[model samples]
Target: MKTAEEKKTRNTKHQKAVLELLKNATKALTADEIREKLADNINKTTVYRMLDRFVEAGKIHFVTGQNGKSFYALCKSCKEEPPKHIHNHLHFQCEICGKVECLPETLKVPQLDNYTIRETQLLLIGTCKRCMNSTN
Candidate 1:
């Protein structure tokens, strides 16, 4: 017997919580990780739907892990008002801990003779500093 407005409001609350979680995350998180961190214990379907909505809104982006798992992270280059998605930096994945993070350094796209480059996805895989330091 819940009204449409009530359902929409609930969805909005969940969306906000997801956004806040991603905003505070240092590394990209998987859907399972996100679900575990949420206080409300949202269902898997609802969590995925929320993530899809955020991706469509351009408020966040996904990086594919080595095992084909997708990790979601906040869009640092996206504008708040219009939510334009612009990714110029590369993604780094730590082999030891399996954490993915966006690198702050932008790539210097090299010019080709004639080919036009519309987009690029560069993922660097190696042991992250935290793992390297821990092993030493």
Candidate 2:
């Protein structure tokens, strides 16, 4: 087993890279994009592996696009030392530009007394105002 400091160090490195990539992104990105951003410093396989680990660790989260591609983004708000993206937030995908936008602090998922709720995936796809207005 690894020591606490070792784990922290690893997490710090992962979070650093994730935030750096997100800081420069206007929309969500796939593991390949992340690998491209990191260049030869890391490979595509390792980027995917790191993404999985970060998602599990709550440092990053996934959102699916209209094209069915999985993209990642940093949480708007995070808990724990490294911070985790809230899973209950809304994800909006613009059909025109293919931008994935997160609508957080909007709504808390509803719970039913008799319902055994596990998880939810909601994606609202449409042309954004910018796109729609541009057509006119």
Candidate 3:
């Protein structure tokens, strides 16, 4: 039987692998995309669960595509307390290629007197430079 420490180590290893995949990705990726790149064959359900855990832990954020498909990206400004994750950044989706990328800039959240904002997602859709250049 595996000891508690061994099990924790195994779990951490898997989590690190998943995080590494997201960190290296230039574009947001679906669970399938992440799974395809992993060296080990991790279960689809496990991938989804890991994604959820990461989101809750403020390590990543999810963006829903125009077609309703969800993609995950790493949170560049994650914090441990107060605001666990920052969602002020904008996401750009290439309408032609259906690729999603996180822009380096951030948007200011409007202040409401009696409202507490949990998160905000802004998705901008357009033909990316690569696609536009390719068409010429």
Best by lDDT: 3
RMSD after CA superposition, every candidate: 3.1, 5.0, 2.2
Extract clashing residue pairs from model 2: 58-84
Local distance difference test, each candidate: 0.84, 0.72, 0.86
Stretches of candidate 1 off by over 4 Å are: 79-84, 108-120
lDDT of 3 by residue, 38-116 (tens): 8888789988989998887788998888889888998866554436355888899999999998888888888889988
**TM-score against native, each model:** 0.83, 0.71, 0.86
Candidate structures ordered by TM-score, highest first: 3, 1, 2
Q: What lDDT does candidate 3 reach at residue 113? A: 94
Displacement of the residue 110 alpha carbon in candidate 3, Å: 1.7
User: Residue 62's C-alpha lDDT in candidate 1?
Assistant: 83
> Could you tell me the TM-score of candidate 3?
0.86
On the 0 to 100 scale, the lDDT of residue 132 in model 3 is 100
Over the stretch 1-136, how does candidate 2's per-residue lDDT look in tens digits?
A: 9999987786567657767887677777887777777634665666777788877776677877778788888755655443323477677888888778776644566767997544345678988888899998
Error of 3 at 116 (Å): 1.8
Which is superior by lDDT, 1 or 2? 1
